[model samples]
Target: MLEQLLIFTRGGLILWTCKELGNALKGSPIDTLIRSCLLEERSGAASYNYDAPGASYTLKWTFHNELGLVFVAVYQRILHLLYVDDLLALVRREFSEIYDPKRTVYNDFDETFRQLRMEAEARAEELKKSKQMVKPVNNSKKQGQAQKAGFDKGNKKREGSSAAGATKKGWFSSMFQSIAGKANLEKGDLEPALKALKDRLMTKNVAEEIAEKLCESVAASLEGKKLASFTRVSSTVQAAMEEALVRILTPRRSIDILRDVHAAKEQRKPYVVVFVGVNGVGKSTNLAKVAYWLLQHNVSVMMAACDTFRSGAVEQLRTHARRLHIPIFEKGYEKDPAIVAKEAIQEATRNGSDVVLVDTAGRMQDNEPLMRALSKLIYLNNPDLVLFVGEALVGNDAVDQLSKFNQKLADLSTSSTPRLIDGILLTKFDTIDDKVGAALSMVYISGAPVMFVGCGQSYTDLKKLNVKSIVKTLLK
Candidate 1:
């Protein structure tokens, strides 16, 4: 059943509600939606899931940008609600026609909503039936496509070689040959260049989806622009693509760890940072690297062996602690990680440590039990930063991992304002060479900056992300 529906202004003023004030939402689901999704520029996601003590919620929101209104629907997450989106659209249309900023209550619109919900549900049922009827045909088509795919797989290398050789004249040069110094650029004119760029990005290990979107963005920015005298289309396209790549790799927010550490020192509290990622991505190794970096600045650091699930996790951090001449807090394996982290922070505070680096067990994003435990630790401790330690060699899995990690953090959080990944630590950077598209893909997907890259096995091997160098390598 749908729990609630709310209509409000972007300014945080409640205009209407489907449920009575007596039965208003207990947990701030709307607040969570705005904080974890909208404010993070994740409005493009289809739905957001929130959890409360008794029930979980799936939220769908639609914005009436022209009128500065937000329409949100909240329902039990256990049920698959297909008509929620249609209902939202219908309500937006019908309500906006009657919406007025001066009026706060919408008593007369209840009748319209009753009729709209019925229409939306009816449409969903009819669409579901039609899809079921066509399921067999779709299955047959999929089988045919699968066979064609296998055949194509055998000839892929040949086709790729032919395409690569076909670009001997260069994609942009081919266009220049056709256009012969055209004054204005057009979308169709950039097709060859875009295709070449996509292939180039894919070769560098960029996800196909990210490559496609980057090409589209570059095409849009270059389309309808006037060209200069003797300017080759190749040069123009290269410059635009370079600029786009650099923009994507650039950090949008402040990633100054040292500054934040000093700020925490002033407040007499430890600057807590939690390192997390999948199995064998080097969370413990990178956590030590980060501890070394902080120690270099004369910051007293403590390691929290919150990775209690792994076999050698605590001993690993203790070894790092011994080498780094820092203290470590560990209760051994099978202990609650949240409790361990909490106790570690308390010890750090008592020992006058400037920073607390929490190393958690490596886990696949799809592991629900581990994910929930990770979320609990984060929610309980509220670290100053959550650095996702991902490998630089990851390709398309980079996007999937980061997105699901953030999703799980949001969905499993105990509070309205959930703590999400604030930064990234890219391990095995020296091994990747020119294939630096993983950084771009991770940053683009999570909107979190790559704060440090691990270049060696040594503790002092951490270094800052070189955005310009990466852009040059990608273009090269």
Candidate 2:
């Protein structure tokens, strides 16, 4: 039987996955295997199979050469190999109907996947029933005997029906009565509700551990609280969950960049804000957006193109600065970023600019030399606030990046106040659907609140994080 299906792009990004109810493939092992398959170059076959402890794994994939997409279906049970091709065709047809690679973000296709899963399961069920009906029956005498036995069983069942109905009715009545009579919330009563919430969070790409923790916190808060009535149970549980999420999101709410810039102007110095993150996370664009925001508030802003390593990085910042009509400081390619940053601050001060936004090279958190250089820039320049720019689609990977960056900076700093990430700026927020787990995981892991969310390509798209909006999104 078809147990599960997973679709992945060539980059090994999980586009969507569906599993039979109550049968979730262990995520880590499957992820590891899929990553291996994606990285493997020797295989030219369209299909592959592997044997594992609980289930047999089969991979059937179709590649869209022009789009560079690899559509993979993972079947757990042994079935005819021909069906795999049919399944892939179905997926490809459905994907083409709803998704446009250039226009639509892939993360928002959960509902489409749900519909596909429903159709696939229905087809599988029909196949199974057809197979069962094809089995031949025994002789007429044996059939007559089976019929007589079935009649006897049915008569006995009817005779016992009243007793069984009474028992079931009493049990259900007691359960509802207990729920309505102010009984303290128990694990049995809360498990189903919390599981649903946890599942919802997981579907949003939140890490399992984080989702479990959030649900646990909500469950703990609701535990031992007397339920006013069965009718009110859902609302009461939702309230508890909302309160828990708000608590996580509410800390460090005030960003107030304009106020800070004005204060710095009074002190005759430019306030510095540095943007840091891995490659292609919209650091330069977001910095420009911030500059536009500051410029709107009448704060003079200058940008420092400190990203000296990556080719064309400086020019990218310069382009954004030009488009925004803001001054930019660049020392050209291969120049020391720290020196550029320091000189930029000096220039901003000399120009009477209220704020300087320094753009740094994006390097992986594990890249030691680059990380050390980043720490040096932070220590040498001592920016007022160091913000980590993260991609919303990366989920827990963003958390890992922030944690390592904070740790690296803390290790490099000799000052009593280590240079920790002051806040996070999550880019591509609008590209994601409801899976706001990156926000929760980033804050919870790094202890840095989200300061701003970059929702769109426009300058006006940057908005401060709203607690109610975030909580509502999570619950929704």
Candidate with top lDDT is 1
Alpha-carbon runs more than 4 Å astray in model 2: 1-180, 230-232
TM-score of each: 0.65, 0.62
Error of 2 at 345 (Å): 1.4
Q: Find the 10 residues in a row with the least total lDDT in model 1.
A: 36-45
In model 2, the Cα lDDT at residue 96 comes to 59
Q: What's the lDDT of the predicted structure labeled candidate 1? A: 0.85
Q: Write the per-residue lDDT of candidate 2 for residues 1-476, one digit (tens) a residue.
A: 45556665656666666533335554344554443333322123455666666667676666553344557666664666335566666777777566566553555565666666667667866777798785776669888999999999998989799788888798887778656655566757778888888887777777787777777656644655567755555677677777767766776346777787778889999999999999999999999888888888888889999999999998888889889888899889888899899999999989888889999999998888998888889989999889999999888889888888888888877676778899999999998888888898887666678989999998889999887987788888
lDDT of 1 at 448: 90
For candidate 2, give the lDDT: 0.77
- Can you write out model 1's per-residue Cα lDDT over 1-476, one digit (the tens) per residue? 67788899978898888744225565888999876555433454668898887778899988775577889899889999889999999998899999988999998887788888889999999999998884444557888999999999979988999888887868876577556666567767778888888899988888888787777656655665666556766678889888777766777667888999999999999999999999999999889888888888898999999988989888988998899898899898999999999999999999899999999999999999999999999999989999998888776676789989999999999888888999989889999888988988888788798999999999889999989998888878
Enumerate residue pairs that collide in model 1. none
Cα deviation at 92, candidate 2, in Å, is: 60
**Cα-based RMSD of candidate 2:** 19.5
